[model samples]
Target: MDWSTKRKLEYFGILVAAILLFVVLPFFIFIYKPPTCFDGKKNSDETGVDCGGSCRLLCRAEALDPILKWDPRIFRVSLGVYSLLAYVENPNVSAGVRSAPYIFRIYDKEGLLILERRGSTFIPRGKTFAVFDGNFSLEERIPAKATFEWGELVWSRTTVSGPEISITNKALMREETTPRVEATVENKSLEPIRDLELTALIFDSDGNAIASSRTFLEYLDKGGEAEVVFTWPQPFPTRAEVCAAPVDVTLVLDRSGSMDDLGANPPQPLTDVKNAAVYFVNLLHEKDQAAVVSFATEAASPIESVLGRNFEAVKRAIERIAIRETDIQHTNIADGLLKAKEELVSSRHASAASQVAILLTDGVATRPEKGGDPGYPETYAQQVANDMRQSRIALFTIGLGKNVNESFLRSIASSSEEFFLTPTAKELRGVYKKIAEKICTTRAAVIEIIPRIYPR
Candidate 1:
């Protein structure tokens, strides 16, 4: 009786299990759902809506910061019109933003806000791309400082790639007052390209970027080439003029006993000063001329004139200036200025286009009287500075260390910007470099943007 009952029960259980597997299992399979990226729900392993799990796009919080290589470059297009360019890099190989808000602010030399441009542009993925703005007009203000900043962006996975454009046969023509740049742009991509933006930057012989221009192309067929020209309304200074333009620069350095003080980080004030002076000499253009004058109680005589092309001679002259160890530790600024003036007027460089005097001192003017009765040395130096200005020679003054007279140095300089205060010898090289840059460059009158399009 037990065997027969057990067999019947087992057969009944098997029938029940088969019915559940075939019918009920199919009903549940048709009704249930799994998580997906496009479902608009925070399901699956996603950190945010449709991003940050296995999705290619990243959430805003997970994105890395954008890298700006340098400050935005502003070019003066005309009297009041300007052009701006910013180079930015996106580190994420897969992340990008279609558009990002940006602000370009222009400030005057005194740090006064002049104008600001607010705009948005496409931020390409991966590699560096340039953000450009043209024809920014300010009624009468001249910009001295320009800054560019980007607003928050939503990063997404992108398939956008740079257009395959190659530049060839680039030539800069300076025959006219307006300089022109000729270049051929080739499109190597399989598809036709349109509305391509191109920019050209003009650098001086010293590798200082002086001017920039931008142009656009309407269309380019695949494997086609088009010639484009960028011309400035105002002719660039001729290469001959740039190379031949004469500049007379005289460096007046203080070699007083206090100069031997261990003020610099390595405690080498005199050596640092010599190095800085040599660096300044090296920055001069080939046609420019330089002179060295050192003073303690009195100025050095028999001023040696060194051509900029003879950089080694100038550096040797600078290194030869030695600190005075005598009882007279007085800073005879008047003697130094007088000697510099004499050197400038006597040298053939008197006819130079720009004559500049750079006076660097570590202490106050102590000798009011070089030989006569006691007189105001500071006043005498100021008068000499005025006379030099009247002669069309610009004067720049650098006050080093804490004992220097800022007011006196400021009075000697042609303008506020011409006076540099360096509390330590470590900054002497940078100051000298700045002065050299100012002396060697000329301001461009106009920057022109010419756009030409060729049909592929």
Candidate 2:
């Protein structure tokens, strides 16, 4: 009787085990899932929610930060209205964000916040793009500084591709007082592109971007081209009053014996300097007045307060400047600057317009006796530079040759960036052109509205 009961129990146990293995286990397996990257919970080796480690997209800490190529630039459109542009670059080739918030802060000259505008835009992957904000108006406040700041960005993995386009030709033209730009864009891509956005940035010769504008194209077939135009109802700050606003500029030339040393190719330092000076004279617009002061041991004006419109006279004066042959044929930079200041002050256009002095030197200030302090020409030059700064006159110093004291030149200029150091006299013309552009153009009102992007 006991063996029969035991056998029945064993058979019942085997039947229960088979049912659990075949039916119950399969049912549980059908409803179960393994941990994956897209799952709501971060169970794998992920650094953040569904990111880092095995995920295609990187975690915030692992992703590269966006590069700001340049600071935001604000262009005054009218008395109260303005336009703004910020150039930003994404360094990651495969990371992109659908939307990124940004802020443009406008500040007064005293660094007081006038107003701020906030907006959001998409950032193209691995490409530099300009964020344009336009039609910003203030009742009577004028912005002296504008700054751009980006908010927290949520980047996602994306495949980025775009139509290849090239700028063929571009020019800035003013119709009356309004500023306009005409440019040609050519599509070189094999595929057609639609809704193409084009941006135009106008930079002065000093590489400071003054204005920016944007245009759009509906469609562009492969290998096709389009003419794009950007215009503003208000004139640029440089051309606000056209040639009516006068600028009195004095040229301070170094006529030391060392000026004969030709470091430039073809070896003609004086000739090159004169040619560059003449070129600078020609660059000045009408209603601007210029004077040439040559110096060695002494400073003398060749073209004493000549009007900029009298181009021939200015050229003749520049060409006539010769190296001093006296026993004291040493650089007297202080004397040259003082003579230039006198010319600028005595000019009829001086009081009504901007005053600028551009001093080009090939050697150190040698004639310290002429500086009113023997053996302290640099200190005397610094004093003169300080006086020029106090007078609100912009001073630009161009240092030619390797021996030219860069530190002294920097001290003489209004700012370090305003000092031009050229390895050879060949680059003097280019440097002069940049200075000329800055002199002729009005100083841009720079207002840094926002701080830089902070690291997390």
Candidate 3:
């Protein structure tokens, strides 16, 4: 071996060893990182990234169903303005670059498009980012099924990597379950199951299972409560509620020739009558019905027909009733009550609830055939009262001003407790609520009142 040849050979060998130790070894180390396979690449979070033979990132597709740490699945529609949420979750990425653009598609059955939304955000890694609330409208009308995806920025370019979700419609109402009646089968299960199939046999007050409503339980997570609601039109008896239910009330006001006289209150009979009638109507609930019947010589047609469901309606009806104008040739108490009763009776439908009539008269009854007093005319009043009682009607009588027969007015009332015998004109408004309150009180089938005895 020559000395020069041997030295050159040794240098070549050292060079080969250095290349393998530094360059080739570092390349192999980078290629075999923890997420990398034997091939060499960075694994994607959800979508499995395809490294594709010596690429830095092993991008197959983002991993689907990344364990959601802060995923609040149950949400309210009100939280989002339009309807898009940015979902971001990455354990390794920086807080700033953690969140990416997400495309949300709400679909219906038959793969119909309901809503499609896009949102970009800075998602915190490992933390669920659902803050983006963009207002969007749903195109399709579907009962429940919905799906969402997060990955690609565009709908067409969406890369399915984030959570694969089976979106469900949030509960329509918060209190879905109501307190069930007693004597029913009790569910002993502690874990309240929502969307559970259940069969219910409904019974009337008579204890006969008349009809049944099919429904499923909706689970509310907060209080561990479950509510099941169903729609079934059961054969409810003609619920004879006196005045609690929404009703059309007509106040028959007597404003005839006899009402012109100023009795205890030195205005006019018509003045007190108008004031009292106005006050009475105002005391009614907004859902209640109201009309003022001011009768004079020619009997003015209902000043205001059935009104008073909203503020505007009640205000307008009050304005009409309070109008100070009349033809005071004669008084017609019986006629006004009869007309009011007829109006109320005719306004109701076969399916409607009961109606009420409040008749206010200052003086006695007078007509073409009969004049002055007419012996109180209790017969006509009684007839109207009887008719009302039979038809499940409630009649409230108010003896306003002076020259009013308290006994006759009492006889006209469906019940003795409903007659309003007021001594003063100014107290008319207070009396109105008292009468209305009496009507609004729950009228049950039967009540057994036990008198309480006390020693003084």
Local distance difference test, per candidate? Answer: 0.77, 0.76, 0.50
Best by TM-score: 2
Q: What TM-score, computed on C-alpha atoms, does each candidate reach?
A: 0.49, 0.52, 0.45
Which model scores highest in lDDT? Answer: 1
Worst 10 residues of 3 by lDDT: 447-456
Residue-level lDDT tens digits of model 2 in 330-405 = 8889888887776666635556788888999889987666435565887787888888888777899999888888
Each candidate: how many clashes?
3, 9, 21
Off by over 4 Å in 3: 1-244, 263-267, 308-328, 347-353, 368-377, 442-456
Task: Flag the better candidate by lDDT, 2 or 3.
Answer: 2
Supply candidate 1's per-residue lDDT for 305: 46
lDDT of 3 by residue, 1-456 (tens): 999999999999999999999999999998865654333333543233333334333233422333334322212232232233223344433122334465566655677766666665433333333333333444335423334555642111222233211112212111123312111112334433343333333332233322222333344232243334433222222222233356667777665555545553444655665666666666665456665566644345644554334545544553444323433356656566667766676634223445777877766665533456555455665666787778776888888766777887787788788787776567777877787677675532211111111111
Instruction: Rate residue 239 of model 2 by lDDT.
Output: 35
Of 2 and 3, the candidate ranking higher by TM-score: 2
